[model samples]
Target: MSYHFGRGWSKLTPYLLLLPGLFFYFLISLGPSIATGFFSFTDATGIKGAPIRWIGLDNYREFLFMGRASLDNLDALKRTLIFSFVVTTVQFTLGLIVALIVNQKLKFTNIFRTIYFMPVILGVVIQGLMWSLFLYPLGGPVAKFLALFGMRSEFLGGQPTEAFAWVIFVQIWANL
Candidate 1:
């Protein structure tokens, strides 16, 4: 009868040990996010310290509602949405294509995989600086390359459409 089932504390011991881990999990992950969500509704900035005024829905209303004070914020929101959607779709398509290619029995499949993932292994700050250098309007490689072909346009600074397209093209090129 004693060995028919485990002792009482034996079963509960594992769960008791797991309690600290669960507490830390909530503290590290969900705690900051919830705090940030609460702060977002308040006009809390470092410079205007001390008193924090709760702005309710003023920020969201101004950005999303009509006849608001700052239409530039609305336009920026639209551009951000469009950019996010386009980047997501394009990156997903590129990933699929890369996966399909890498699934094949190519001679240099491992090498190709390493090359493709190399950028991801690199530091984000370094990558951003590198691209900022490469995409600089006046003296970047892209502008110079276009100039070589007698097709000159400010690849990064000419216009919004041109800048956006160039950014997308560079993203596709470097990522895939």
Candidate 2:
């Protein structure tokens, strides 16, 4: 037997081929997205079958105006914004510089171009894990070298400012 599509059926082939993708998209992506949007307006405890009361704007109020709210969430937001902006700026600047250097027709610049794109081939999780290992203060080689001075505090466990600083530095190092 052979599979064939008549001229009429050919017009529907793309949709037929896309059905599986559409099914999975609705099941995995759209379903959760709509649920999240709906849940935002309700007080739904994570417990299965629990009652979910409509509490429109109440949750948003606490996050926006509660006294202690700013200390926790707002501080985190500020730090994240700063870190992301700095890292993006560095990436853009470095990309431009590398592109300029590689465009100069230098012999070894092709090697640098290959090296620069190597990170792009790795998944974000893998790149993050590799950088984490590089900066791990306990048993990492970098930390071992610092251990000679009797220092043992991990990069991320130090003071808040310093820890955030290292986070920015490590992100830039990994991405650049």
Who wins the TM-score comparison? 2
- List the candidate 2 regions with Cα displacement exceeding 4 Å: 1-7, 114-157
The lDDT, on a scale of 0 to 1, for candidate 2 is 0.81
Candidate number of the best lDDT: 2
Candidate 1 similarity to native, TM-score: 0.62
In Å, residue 54's CA in model 1 sits off its true spot by 6.7
lDDT for predicted candidate 1 compared with the true structure: 0.78
Alpha-carbon local distance difference test for all models = 0.78, 0.81
lDDT of 2 at 29: 100
Which tens-of-lDDT digit does each residue in 1-176 have in candidate 2? 54466567786898899999999999999999999999998999899999999999888777767889757887888888998899999978987897788789788887888877877798888877886786677797778877899877565436788778777776776678
Predicted candidate 1 versus true structure: per-residue lDDT over 77-168, tens digit per residue: 77788877887889889889998998999999999989788787877677778878887768788779888988765646568887777676
Q: Cα miss at 141, model 1 (Å)?
A: 4.5
